[model samples]
Target chain A: MKLTTLAKTVAAAAIAMPLMTAAASAYELVIPTLDYRTGAYAPNGIPFANGFTDYLTLLNNRDGGINGVMIKHVACETAYNTKQGVECYENTKNTEPSGALVYQPLSTGITYQLIPKSAVDKIPVFSMGYGRTSAANGTVFPWIFNFPATYWDQATVFVQYIGDKEGGMDKLKGKKIALVYHNSAYGKEPIRTLQKMSAKYGFSLLLLPVDHPGQEQKATWLQIRRERPDWTLMWGWGVMNQVAIKEAASIRYPMDHFIGVWWSGSENDVEPAGMAANGYLSGAFHAPGDKFPLHDEIKKYVYDKNQGTGERERIGEVLYNRGLVAAVWTVEAIRKAMEIHGTKEVRGEQVRDGFEALDVSEARLKELGLPGFTYAVKITCANHQGPGKVALQQWNAKAKQWKIVTKFYEPLSDITGPLIAEDSAQYAKENGITPRSCN
Target chain B: MSPDFLFFLEIIVSGLMAGVMYSLVALGFVLIFKASGIFNFAQGVLCLFAALALYDFIAPGGWVDRWFGFTLPVWLGIIMTAGVMVIVAWLIERLVLRYLVNQAPIILFMATIGLAYVLEGMGDILFGSDVKPLDIGLPQGASDYMLDTFGLYVEKLEIVAAFVAAALVAVLAVFFQKTRIGRALRAVADDHQAALSVGISLRTIWVIVWSVAGIVAMVAGIMWGSKSGVQFSLSLIALKALPVLILGGFTSVPGAIIGGLIIGVGEKLAEIYVGPLFGGAIENWFAYMLALAFLLVRPQGLFGEKIIERV
Candidate 1:
């Protein structure tokens, strides 16, 4: 009996030995990026994916890995379509190297569809600029995180910027402001926020919708010509931005009075208009141009070695920087996760904890060479967007660059907090989501 | 009540102008269909290409930036654009449409779809994917001088577009009725085999018809592109013309104009007065629904020849 028991113990030890060794050896964190490398939006998508991949590569090459855990990233191209993005999410959800913490869909449409699924799968979705703005309320949407800013935050800042430009908030009392937007959920996101503000500010709001892909806007512009609105807020994407700018210019509308969201502002948006795009302003979450140290490092480490993803000149443009910033936030979240879990090897849940605990301070931003880029943001039990601020940048004709004019912060707690809560409750009721109690 | 009445009138007039724009695109499709019995799916892309070419020529500090030193004047750029369209027409006929002339209508239609991609790629390569302001030197600020008491304010661009379209239609009517080439075109369109037997070269007629279509597309491009800027998405306006073609006959110019007007005005009025009750954005689908309803009632469209198959 003793001899038989000894033999069984030996067999068990042989089976368990390799796994323990494997666990102690170098571990890997597999991150799956759902990228759109081709399609109607490839102009924006390709560069963003390139930046994302390059940043991951940068972490591997420069710092060896995130907290010594090498990241194994696999990119599945979705081509900016929602169905393909979901398919990619499903295919890469449980990929080897175990912890697939975050998924950035890069499309609001896809983000909306994935929100419920992500929550069920226990994987967090990071929809930075575009998504259901109410998803910013983390209490109901525990798995969805739209850090830095929400559409409502952007709308509030846009109004605040207009108020600032007019010298005071009182100047907005009787002005006619037009919201020329693409007729999609992403386009209509700021409507409720803008309408609410307009009601309070006593400004007239004209809602104008340009259909998807926004090529033909003669009727919309004709309305603009008819109404003669004092200011126009553009919520557009891809070719839509250029069309709006051109139409506004053709009508001889003051370009300075026209404002676009961050997605609406890019080198592609103005390159077509050239001189005609002068004085057009857009609210930006990050500054344009690649003057940041991280950019310089990318140039030195990546581009210099011909390891860059895009053309050398396009390395630090607005969209490219935004992509890099998105990567930074992601990696920082991972770092935070490692800090809390007391080990480099963490699961998707631990990564979520990290995101919730992120405290990106001004000092840390400056250290990262993203000075004046963003304020200190902290995600909490109820707030997923964190402290949001936007800067207004105008296209200068002489300098041929976007110059930051001023920064505006919305009254988040007073305005957005209640709205988010109410919206989350409504959304929870509709989606049959049970809100988590913080206590 | 007066404000609502005024708003209604404004919507109707504006919608009519939009209809004219749609008619211009529908006219290109009609021209191609009349000559070749194949719908030119690339007509919208052709419009976009022409407009982008014109804008690029005039925009300062571009590919030809050093040639003119600064910006080329509007008239010169427009003339150059016309020359470019003629070349594009020749190339398209020689390289694509000519080869598929004897193929099925579906095959020919698919060829135009291929041509659309080629043109889009070439356009993006040549002009880049940026939106450029199309400054065609049309009069501006006319909308401000409103006949307020009559509840009417006319935009100068709209006035210009109406006149240009009317003039083009008149010119085309005269060309088709008065010119010998026009007679040959009509003959070829009527009976291809008979026209070929009569010693009229189908190739020459095809080239001429496509050239004319190209010119019309350029004019339409300028009007629409100037209003909305020349971009890739500008080609989607062609979809708007599909319902116009269904409403009108595929071979009738007057049908195109009238059909465009009906669809445009109908959708606008429905949206303004009836839309809010149902939901806004009804205008987006109303045009197609109206056309579909019309097709159910009149399969040959308002002017299309009724096909009577005898098995």
Candidate 2:
């Protein structure tokens, strides 16, 4: 055991040698990834970490590192633990010329921890789609970003999808919609938005929270069975997702009406349930499958060169693709930062500006070879979440794939707008930060 | 008949079924604690390690396929897994536990906790962190007859787990009652010095007892892993059976069983009936609270040996 510890110490030092030296350099843009590759969340987390790291490698190999300057990416494993995630942040936050370009704390709890720290350090924390939804109001949360769609945006869009199917929004009146959420800050993020929407649509909403590491949810599911809700939308992660799907199947619930947030929809979540989890729909920003043009690029340049990160096959899984999307945005923000600052090497603060001004148009999507894969994303000075949009996808059991089956649902900023303003304003007031207008 | 009453009945029935597996896990802790005065904290993680090994044996994943070249059949795979567990038990005794013998019981207990961390890390390295489905052709899904007949709505797997737990208990009972080694174990449990003098080697008994616990842990791993997935959380849930240990009593086998059922049933009912008033998810701590309350009243547990230290 001592030998093993010594070996691990030597191995860690060997891995850290580059970053330690790289911190003194001034040429490359260093993005330190506080990722969870080893712990309870690793099964779901490994692919995301792999995809994130692989994208950086792919850029270095295929494009000679995000234009001329190489992208130096370092990962410190947090094991999906908040303390370790924060520790990773503090340890790796210092990288060369200015500071670590940006930190993406994938776990929401870790993201929450880093929010104030990043603002203080002037380092942007990109939470992608699963952090505090109120962070969308860029006026208040200038350093924090949860772009594309927040959990609130997801709830409303899910309602829209259900409305689209049932003729219209008015048709949802008096309908019972259950939200089986994982009981956490991440899980509870959607309730307020959902409650507001439920009132507007006249739909009855049931909130059933499954505690952390949700393995024993027999009682929760049994409640679902008795209530017989018209639709059940799950906000779950890890083992909770798989268990919920299986329990839903066992209760003979119609798989079509039972939808889950993107996190709840993955190969890991559904494959175990086999045919029972068929037709289980979920909201997604990016399509699943490795058939994308960039995947071919990733395959040829990355895996073919034997520079891949994880199982060669899991390159385009739901979360893996989400990781790819996250990396693309992070790099895109840096590029915008470079363009705005008119310099090859930009610091952490400049990257925040780049993120605000960054836009992924339909033409740009075509240029990036991700056309029709996702919608044109645009971030403004005031709205950090961009055009918060997500489409629906369903699990095809026979083929074992997540196939996007709907066009992007427009985000209902009308409901989410006021909530964000109120929440962000409250946050700003509590923190004693004079809000930026950005006009 | 009101639907509420029927649903209540359903909850209780399902809770008992879930409790059966908890009893299986608690049973392992009981066996080890009864024979040796050490609280084996790694009993939970043993479930995880055993399950992972069983999965690797049954389904030779990428790493196994690279070297071994073939997957063992289910029955054969189980035997191989049991063999691996026996080696693990032997190693634990020879390496760690052997050194701690005659030390304070609390010291021995703390050593097992340390062992759990070491074994957890080892488990992660050996069997990667990915969640593997432990489908050894174990029955899953709801029982059609139960669902159709009385709206009982019980999982087929839970029923299988209950029967498996019952069979394990019966076998364990016969082993301790009739077998010479079992007699040796009981003799050691009564008084280590007296048993040592009667031609029973203490080292051999410790190894045997730990091996039995390991086998019990292996069975639990299969039962629970097949229900959920063979992942880190399996070990974590296995730890949850701790509350069952206190309720059942440290030295009582039958106590573990009854305590497991009471806690399981109690918690499920609490979550279903009382959870809503408190905003739900009461099941998580409900069992521990019940155990804590029960322990206050009956310190010896449901069937625990009375602790009467002679002055």
Best by DockQ: 2
User: lDDT tens digits, residues B26-83, model 1?
Assistant: 9989988987798999999989888888887887655567575787787888788888
- TM per candidate comes to 0.81, 0.95
lDDT of each: 0.81, 0.88
lDDT digits (tens) for residues B142-203 of candidate 2: 99998998887899998998888888888998889899999999999999999989888988
Q: Poorest 10 consecutive residues of model 1 chain A by lDDT?
A: A407-416
Considering only N, C-alpha and C atoms within 3 Å, which residue pairs clash in candidate 2?
Answer: B248-B255
> Where does candidate 2 stray beyond 4 Å?
A1-26, B60-69
lDDT tens per residue, model 2, A1-439: 6999999999999999999888556488899988776666788888888888888999999888877788888889998889989999999889664569998888899999998998989999899998888998888899988898899889889999989888999999999999999999999998999899999999999999999898888899889989999999999989898889989999999999999999988898888787899999998998888888888888899999999988788888988988888998899999999999998889999999999998988888778767777888889878888788989999999999899999898889899999999999999899998888787
lDDT of 1: 0.81
Q: Which consecutive 10 residues in model 1 chain B have the weakest lDDT in total?
A: B140-149
True contacts kept of each: 0.23, 0.52
What is candidate 1's lDDT per residue for A199-220, written digit by digit as tens?
8888999888777776655557
Lowest-sum lDDT 10-residue window in model 2 chain A: A20-29
| DockQ of every candidate | 0.20, 0.62
